[model samples]
Target: MKLVLNTFFSFFLVSTLFGQQYRVLPIESYFKDISFFTDSSFTPIFPVSDNQVNYYNTTKEQKLRYATVGHYIYQREIIQVIKKEGAIWASPILDIQSGVERGDTAMSQYLNVRGLRIEGSMKNKVFFSGSFYENQAVLPYYAQQYVTNRGEFYPNSSDSSYHQVNAVIPGSARTKPFKTNGFDYAYATGMVQWQVLKSLSVSAGNNPIFVGSGYRSMLYSDNSLPTMNFRVNYTLGKKWNFQLIRLQGLNLLRVPYASNGEALYERKALSIGSIYFQATEHLRIGLIEGGTWTRGDSIQKQAVEGGFYIPIPGAATIQEGINGKSYAYLGLDLNWRVWKVLLYGQYGRNPYSKSSDVGQIGIRYWPFKSPNYLVHVEYNHTSSNAYKSSNPRINYSNFNLPIGHPMGAGVDEVIIRLRAEWNHLFVSSSTNYYLNQSDNYRQLLPVYEAASGTNQQVLYETFELGYNFNHGYGLEIFGSAKLRMVKNPLQNEQSYWFNLGIRTALNNHYFDF
Candidate 1:
C-alpha cells in the first residue's frame, strides 16, 4: 500500500519518461465536440477510450512565439512542469465558476465550483489521470427536493447522532451543510492504464462511461457517480473489437452503516461486455451484455457469486435464466452514416419480464457538410418496470442512480437540439418533452405493484450563448437560460432560470431531467 501511494503521488507530481498512449479524453469538450464528429476523416464508436490518444496526437495546437502569457492562456497547459521532447509530460487542470439562477421565489439560486485534474503519461505503454472537485450550490427547487428527500435517513443502533441527516448529492459525492440553505460536497477519481500488447490494454479506475452515439443512451450514460471498475480492451484487425468491464458498485439503501459507525453501503458487482463490428465503411453494429449480483445471500454476507467471465454474447442471459443467481440484460447498438447525416438506435431488454424493455432512435444532420451547424432530434421510451426488479439489490443502478437513463423507468421523451458556431462565438439550444410517471422512478428500490401511478408531463428548454477561448481545456465564457414546466395530478411547477459564468467544462452533469 505504501509503494502504491508513493507511485500515485509521483505520477501526480511528475510523469516518468515513457510514451503516453490511449489517454482518455474528457467527454463534454472533446467527445461531444461537433467539429470533430463532422470531420469525415474521424471514425468513432462513441466514448471508446483507446483511440483518443491517437486523435489527440494528430490534432496540433498553434502556439505564440514571444508572448509567454498569451501562449499559456491560449494553447499551453496552465502549469506544465515537464515537457521534454514529448517523452514525459504532466499538467494541472483547473475549473472555477460562479453563477446565479432565478426561479420560483424572489431568492436566487447560486452555484460555485472549483476543481483540479492531474493527467500524466509514462512512455507509450502507460498512462494515468486524477481529478478532484469541490462544489457549493443552492440548486433549483426540484433538484433540491430530490436530494433532500432521498438522503433523509435516521441513525442506526450503533450511530452517534440520533437525528436524521440529508447529505446525499446525486451525480456527486455526499454533501455537508454549507452556509445557509446550501450544500457543499467534494469528490475525487483517478485512473491507471497499461498496454500489455499491441492490440490489448488493461485499465482500472473510478471512471464514468458513455456507450451511445447520441446525447442520451439506453444502454449506459454518464449520469451517475463514477464507480470503481476494471476494463480490458482488445482489437482484432480492422473489423472486430471487444471489451470487458467489471464494475464494483454500492447500494446505499440496504445497509447504511457498519458496526464501527462508518458508512458501509452494501456491495454489488456488475460484469459487462461489448463486441463491435465494422461491417462497412458507413455502418457499425455492436452487441452488449451484462449481469449484476449481490455480494451475499439473504441470510449472511459472502463472496460474490460466479459467472462473470463468459465472453460470448447472450451467455449471461442464458446463465441467469438457468440458475437465477444474477439479473442479466442484453442490448443491441446500431449506427449508420449516410452522406452528411448520422442515424443511430438502441434496444435493450430485461430478462425478468418481456414487457421490461427500452428503445431509442436519433438522427444528427450537418447542413452543407459543415461542423459549424447541427440539427439533432431523438426519441426515447422505457417500460414501466424496465430497470426495476423484485429484488432491489439486483436492480440496474449504482449509488441510488440509474446506470442507464436519468429518467429511470416508465418514461417517454423527445429531444431536439440545435447548435450554430462562427469564429469564436457559438449558440446552442435544447428542448425536451417528457411523459412520465408522477413519482420519480428509481430502479434501486422495489415499488408497490398494486398501486397505480399518476401520469405527468414536463417541458424543459435551455439556451446558451458562449465565446470559446480555448478548445483543449474547454474554457469558455457563457450565459444561459432555462425554462421548466411540469404538470401532474400531484402538483404543478413552473420555473424560469438564468445565469452567466466562465468555466472549463469537461464532464456532463445531467440536470435537465
Candidate 2:
C-alpha cells in the first residue's frame, strides 16, 4: 500500500512539473454563437449611398474591416460555429489501466466513445448520439472475491472452476463457456426535429427516456427496452412550455438467456410520453407515462411517471417521482451561499424486476466559491434483498437484445468520498463499506459484473490525484486498497495507476473560433 501510494503521487508530481497545456472556459462559451440582427432599427447592407458608401469604406475597408453595410452598419461575429454544424465529431478514447486484488494482478486496456449532436433550424433539425466501447482485461473468479446477489446479499463460496463449468451445449456441438479477449458493444441513435407551426415542433428518434431528476430510475437507463420515439413540443404563455412523446421498441443487439432454447423474444411494444411545464423561472413540473421501448427484452410493459423541481429558501431544490415498473423515488438538491449540498433518497420494488425492494440515499456538499478552488464531501447508502434468483436474467437467447446479461441483485453498501480541486490540480479520496450475503462474489469483484452473488462487509479505499496542462495535455495518478476482515483472509489488495491523456483539435484549436 505504501509503495502504491508513493508511486501514484510521484506520477502526478512529475506530470505537473512537465505537462502540456490546459485552460478553463465557461460552459456557455463552448457552444456556437449567432447574432442574427446587429440592431433592431438597422436594415440590410445592400444598396449604399454616396456619403454612406464612403463611411462604409472608411469603417470596413480602411479601418478594422470588421463588416460593411449602408449608412446602417452592423458588426456581428459568430464563434464556435463548427461545433454547432455537427461536422466535428470524436471517437471513443483508449485508456490503459491496472489493479491488484488480494495480491492478484489484474490489467485492462479499453476504448470508449460517447458522442452527441444537436442541429436544427426554424425549418428543420436533426440530432445524433451513441456510445461504443470495447474492453480487454484479465479478471479473477467470483468465489475468490466478495459479491452481491439479486437479493442484495453477500455470498461466501466460489463457483466451480471455469474449466469445470459446462463446456458444450446439450445434444449439440456448440461451445458452452464462450471465451474471448473481452467484452465489446456499441449503440447508436438519431432524432429529427421539424417545425409544425410557428410555436410548435415535432421530433422523432431513438433515445433513452429521462423523466425525473434522480440519478437512477427505471426509465433512466436503457436496461429493459430500446425504442424509436416521436415527440411534439410547444410553447403556450411566455413562461409555459409543453411536450408529448410516443415510443416503439426496436431490438438490435444480441443478448444471452438461460432458457437454452433460442428465443427471439418480441415485445408488444410500449408507448410512453411526458409533458413539462415551466411555471416560473425557477420551477418546472413534468408528467410522464408509459415506458419507452428499450434495447432489451426483459419485459414489454409501460407505466406512469412524474417529476417536479422547485427552488426555495437557501436555494433549496426538491425533486420526486414514481414510474411504472414498480419504481418510485424522491431527491433534494440545495445550495446555501457558502455551502452546496445534494440530498437524495429513493425506494423501489424490483427496480429490475428482481424480487426485492431497494432503497438508497446520498448527500454531497461543496465548500468554496471560486471555480478553480473547491472541496466536496459525499456519502451514499444502498440496501436491497441481494437475492440471485429474483434478479433479471440476460435474454441472450435472442440476437436482437443488447449485449451482456441482466444485472444481478443483492447489494448493500455505504460510501464516503472527499475531493478537492485547485487550478489545474485535483485530488479525491473515497472509502466504501460492503455487506455480502449471497454466492455472487465474481459479480461484485470486477468493475463490470455478469452474475449475482453476496459480498460480506468489507472496507475499500481509493485515492486519486491529477493535473492538467494548458497545452491540452492531462495526467492522472491513483491507487486503491481493499481489505477483507472476515473469511479465509484473501490478501489485502493494493494497486497504483497512471494516465496520460491529450485533446487535440482536428482543424483549428481556438475556442474563440
Candidate 3:
C-alpha cells in the first residue's frame, strides 16, 4: 500500500497537463437516464465518466446565491471538507427498504444498507473516488435461489467433508445468514486516474467493467463483482479513441484450502483492448478483443508478465494461442441514431469455437426527443458454450458470476423497459422473458447436454414509482411491485412481491433474472 501511494504521488508531481477531474456516473439506469435523454450522440459504451452530466456538475458548485441551511442539507454533498486547488467531497450512502411477497411462500423481506463515498481531484490532474457499503437483506425467492446456487463451498475444518457453505450475494463476495432468510455482505471500490498527457490517461481501480449500451451487454457487463484492474485510455483525435485494460479475476469454484482451512481462490489475468471510431455524425462503431489466462506459479509471482502487457488489440490472444490455452473473445459494438431514436447492437464470440457466441440488438427511443420519457426494447441470445472453458479456471467469470451477462449462458431473452420523469416524480416498468435449455450453463466447464429438468421458461415484470427528494446521491422514496412466473415439465410457479422504501440509489442491483 505504501509503495503504491508513493508511486502515485511521484506521478502526480510530474503530471503537467490540465485536465478536468475525472468522475464517472453510477453504472445504473436510474442515474444515467436524464443524461442519455439529453445527449443522444453519446457513445453506446457504458458508464460515461469523461463526459459532463447534469447530476455530476463538477464545474459549477451546486449552491444558490441565497443559500440556506436546507441547501446544504438536502441539495449538495454533505461536506466539502477540504477545498484546496481542488475539493474533497463526501456523502453518506443509505438504503432502507421493506417488502412482502404473496406467492408459493408468503413472507416479509427487507434491506438495510449503509456506506460512504468520497471523491475528489488533486490539482485537477489526478483524480480519485472511493466508496464502501455494508448491506443486509432478505431477497425474493427467485433472487435467493440464484444466490444460493452460485455460492462456493469448502471442506469442513473438523471432518473434512464438503457441504453447504458460503452463499455469495450477487455483485458481492461471500455472505453470512442475516436472519431466517437473509444475507449480510459488504464490498468496496476505488479508482485513481492520472492524466499523463493531453490525450492520454492512466488509471487503476477495483470496479466492474461495462462495455455495451443495453440493458444487458454481450461484450461485458457490470453484473459480477469488481476486480483489481489497470486501464489506459488514449485519444488520437475527435474521431478515434482507444482503451486497454488489464484485470485480475477470481474463480471461486477451484479454491484450494490453506493449512489453516482458508480458501485460496484461483486467479486469472485478462487483457482487454477496444477501439471506437466516429465514422459519421449518425453512426459509431467499436471493436473489442480480450484474452484470459490462468496465473500459474511462474506468472503469479509477478504482477504481469512483460509479454502480456502489450496494448495492441489481439496481441495477448495471439501470444496465448501459441501456448494452446487461449481463452480469447472478440466483439463489435454499433449504434446508429436516426429519426430521434438510437439503435444499438452487439456481436460477441469466443474466437476458438464457432458455437460459443452471443448476439444482441436494442433501441433507445425518446418519444418526441423529450428528456422526460424513454422506451427501451432489447433482444439477447447466448450459445450454450459461450463463456465456458475446457479448463474451468479461466472461464469468463469472477467469483462464480458471469462477466458478460447476468444469466450464465445458453438462453434467449427479450426485455422491454419504460421510464418517465416529471419534475421530482418518476415511474418505470420492465418486463423480461427467458427461454433456458442448458443444464450446465452455470458450471465453469459447461457443455450442452439434453436434460429435461433444465428446460424451463420464465417471465418477469416489475414496476416502480418514486419521488426524488435530492439528486445528490439520488435520495428517493419508491414503491415497486414484481411478478415472476416459471414453467417447466415438473413444476409451474407464480410469485408476486411488493416493496416500499427510501434509498440513495447509486449502483445496480440486478435481480430480474
Candidate 4:
C-alpha cells in the first residue's frame, strides 16, 4: 500500500505541472484542429483596414472567428468544453491539548486531560470542513450546595435552578455534586458556492457567521450563534452587496441560558431571520427580518417579567405581548489603510425589548511581508440595560439560567497585542482589562464602589501563542488568568491552560480501480 501511494503521488505532481488549471466561467473551449491566424495557412478573407486582418480560415468547424478592432481575439458563437480532470486538494488538522486549571478555593483540584481535535477543508468547488473537541478540565456550573462550618448547609442556586437545589439539599448529607461535564465542543458546517454571472454568485449551507472587527459582536457573537444557518449573498455593481439568512436551529455551545426548563442538549429554538446589506466597502447594516414559530416556546418573552410588561402601566395592558416575536439589528464597520498601517472600527445595536449596543475599534501595523507579524490594539464597549447583572460572585447552581445580577448597563474593555511570525512559526501575546459597572451598586465590592452607589469595576486578562508548519501541521498554546477583587461571593478567580495541535490532508481525486 505504501509503495502504491508513493507512485500515485509522483504521478499526481507531474500532472499538476502541465494540466490547465480549472477556471469557472460561463463557457469554455478547447480544439486541436484549430488553425492559428499567425500561421501562413490562415489568410484574411475580408478587407484589411489599417493593416489589420478581418477573418481567419480554418479546416476545423470549431475554429472560424473574426478578429476584433484592437489586436483582440473574438469567438462569436463557439461553445468551449475543456476536459481537464483528476485534480485533488485536501487539508486536515489534529490538535492535542493538556492543561490544568484551579478555580478559586472551593473547586476541586482537577487534572487536565489531553483533548484532541481534527479539522480540515477540501475543495474543487464542493468543500467540507468540521471540528470536534473534548476536555477533562473544570466545566462551568451555575449552582451548588455545600456544608458550612456550623454543620448546617447552604444551597447556592440561580433564579432558574433554585427550586431544584432547595428540594435536594434538605435531605442529602453529602454535598450534591455540581454537574460539570469537563470540556465539550461540537462539529458543524458544509457549504457550496456556484458562479452564476461574471460579478454575481450564490452560496448556501450551514456555516458560522463572524462579522465585523470586534471579538464580540452584539448582533451575532461567536459564542452566541454557532449553529446551522442558511444564507444567500448577492453582489451589485462594484460597491454594494446584500445577504439574507435564516437560522433554523441554534447550537448554543458556550452560553447555556434558556428560559424553558429543559436540559441544555434538549433546548432548541428558531432564530428570527435576518437581512444584511453592505455598501461602498465601508458600511454594513443588518436587521432581524422577523420571528419564526417553532416547537419550543419563546425564550425572549420568558426573560421578561409577568410574561410581558405594560408600556403604560395601566389602562388595560397590551393583552398579547411580543412573544416569539421578531427583533431588529443594525451594524456598521469601516476600514481605512494609510501606508502600511490599517485602522478599523465597528458598531452595532440589537433593537429587541432588552436591546444592547456594542462598539469596537482596532489598529494593525504590518511592516514586513511575512506570515503573521503585526502589532494590534483594540477596544470594545458593550452596554445593555436589560440583561445587566450586578452580582460579582460566581454562580455554579444552574447551567441553564442567567443568575440574577444586573441587566442592561455598559462594560468596557481594552486589548493590546503584539504578534511575530516567521514562516510556520508564530508567537502572540496580549492582555485585556475589563471595567464593569451596573445598577446594583451596594451588591458589589467596596474597593470599586463610589459614594454614588454604583456596582464596582472589575478586570480580566488572557495571553496566547501558536505555530503552524508546511505540509499541514500546526500547534497552539494559550493561557487565561483573571484577577478580580469583588465583595460579592464570587471570589478572585484565576486559571491557566495550554494546547498543542497537528493537521494534515488526504485526497483521492476521481479514484478509479
* Predicted structure with the largest lDDT when compared to the true one: 3
TM-score, ranked from best to worst: 3, 1, 4, 2
How much does candidate 4 score in TM-score?
0.53
Model 3 steric clash total: 0
- lDDT string for model 2 (1-513, tens) is 777657655643453342211111111100100000011111111111112122211212112222223111222111111222232222222334454444344444222222223222221233333323232332233311211111111122363211111111100111122245332333344455555564666666654443322222222223323346666666676544455554453322122232566433333233333444444433344443332222323333332222211111111011112222212222222211213443434343322434444444544444443222323332223233321121122121111221111122444456565656554466656565555433332331111245433354455555666543221112223333333332314333443333333321101110000
Q: TM-score of model 1 relative to the true fold?
A: 0.86
- Candidate 1 Cα misplacement greater than 4 A, ranges: 1-22, 34-66, 81-103, 152-167, 254-261, 297-299, 368-372, 441-443, 446-453
Per-model clash counts, in order, read: 5, 65, 0, 29
Which candidate order results from sorting by lDDT in descending order?
A: 3, 1, 4, 2
lDDT of 3 by residue, 1-513 (tens): 777656644443332122234556666666555565545455554455644354454222334323345555555567653334665677777788899999898999988888888888776577788889899989887778777767765545575334445576766566888868889999898888787886787888996678877878887787778889898888888778798888887655434446465657656687778988988876889998766766753114334445567786776567556664547778899888777587889998887776788999998898864555789999998887787766665677777777887876777999999988776698989999887733333454211223322767888999999987666567788999999888877779998999998887666678886
If scored against the real structure, what TM-score would every candidate get? 0.86, 0.47, 0.86, 0.53
Flag clash pairs in model 1: 18-122, 18-123, 19-123, 19-124, 20-123
Which stretches of candidate 3 lie above 4 Å from their native place?
1-22, 40-46, 50-70, 81-84, 155-164, 253-261, 297-307, 368-370, 437-441, 445-453
TM-score of 2: 0.47
Deviation in angstroms for 129 in model 1? 0.7
Residue 485, candidate 3: alpha-carbon lDDT: 89
Q: lDDT scores for all predictions?
A: 0.67, 0.30, 0.72, 0.32
Q: Write the per-residue lDDT of candidate 4 for residues 259-351, one digit (tens) a residue.
A: 466434222322323333443333344333221222233122222223112211110112113432222234555545455555667665434
Off by over 4 Å in 4: 1-93, 102-125, 130-181, 184-186, 250-324, 351-355, 386-409, 437-467, 471-513
